[model samples]
Target: MAAVPLQEWERGDKTNVEIIGYGWRVLEYFHAEEKRVMVRLHLPADRDKDRIQLAVMLMLRDIKHSRKWLCEFCGAPARETHTFNFFYRVLDSDLPRLVVYCHFVCDMDKRHVREGLTATHHLMNTRFDGTLGPMPPFASFGKRPSGKVYPLAGSCAGCQHEDTAVDEGVLKRCARCKMTRVCGAACQRADWGRHKVACGMIYSVTFENWG
Candidate 1:
């Protein structure tokens, strides 16, 4: 999804490019114009946040990048992205963290916040409602994005061991959540304290085939 934009950013007349994808968070340091593009995202009144202030934007030139976005609903290439501010913050500013995107299929609602300097729902009308409520923590996106390429196998949560040496092919999934796997009862015991918190949050997604 970001391929064309990267190409445009590198070869087109503009020195910088801007987009708004709805599902991911926003990264500050884009331009003030991009900052203003936030109002249209229709994010829930309360989005999650965190404390770490990221500095990757300042070093954009030195960083190797490979982020390409897709439409959450249609799975098509996306151009513009949406906005939402998760946990990160500065002293007194609202720095949006996640992002959502839209293609030409949607129409801009033609709205702005605070003298067109900030963004609000830029586009909303589409064949179907593409708006998302709020982004979840990066941990719960379900079966990591690379799960297909690298399906996770049972590893001892306690000692982080990976071999079974037997024919059972890894230990059974944790009984409660049916997601976590451990090498044996003892390892599960050692890791129980840490895994409990995450186990409660690991409910499967509604879509069976989703990653």
Candidate 2:
């Protein structure tokens, strides 16, 4: 995580925090008591960061709806008192933000997630909250995403079939992300449901940056 400079701000002051992986900004103020000010931002994308953000949003919503806290990642009892409000979609007038308490262990090295997602053309973010309760009913959080394992350079994203495998010479790459590879059309089709979101978002990024 990029170090959030706070030399200018007084403690207990409300601030705005931008959730962009590449920058730092204030967002919301989670009160000393459990304000549980979880945010709901309507957005779309399919990179690792996007995937991870989606995962977290569902979790926060689960916590808010349940009115309790559990460790979002490790399923441990989490009572740490630290919070962050990450707002990703800035173009919109209503920037949704959430400030939830998270464990130091779970919240450490967030920058790694951002950089790793960028390098792999994947996307994700991790900010853990120690909200303990029954395991969330995941079905309510929309379709569970398929496994997003990063395949080898020449392996099939669907079946993990390698280029050297019989009848699998020269894997066909997804033109959208230019990153995902598969053994053939069969494997490509198998992976479509999983790859489509990331593929579209990545290509959109490239399109936006065409200069």
Q: Which candidate is the best by TM-score?
A: 1
The list of candidate 1 runs beyond 4 A from truth reads 1-46, 51-153, 165-169, 205-211
Backbone clashes for every candidate come to 34, 17
lDDT at 43, model 2? 31
Across 1-211, the per-residue lDDT of candidate 1 in tens digits comes to 2223232112222112122323223344572211111111112223322211121121110010112222333333222222332222212223222322222111112232111212232223232253423333323523323322221112344554324312233555567755455667887798788666545433221111112
Q: Which tens-of-lDDT digit does each residue in 1-211 have in candidate 2?
A: 4534433221223222212111111234452222222222223432235544554443322221121222233322222212233333322213222233322112222354323323322112322232222233324424424553222222356675333222223656566555455667887798688666545433111111111
Which residue window of length 10 is worst by lDDT in model 2? 202-211
Model 1 alpha-carbon miss at residue 198, Å? 0.3
Residue 25's lDDT within candidate 1 is 30
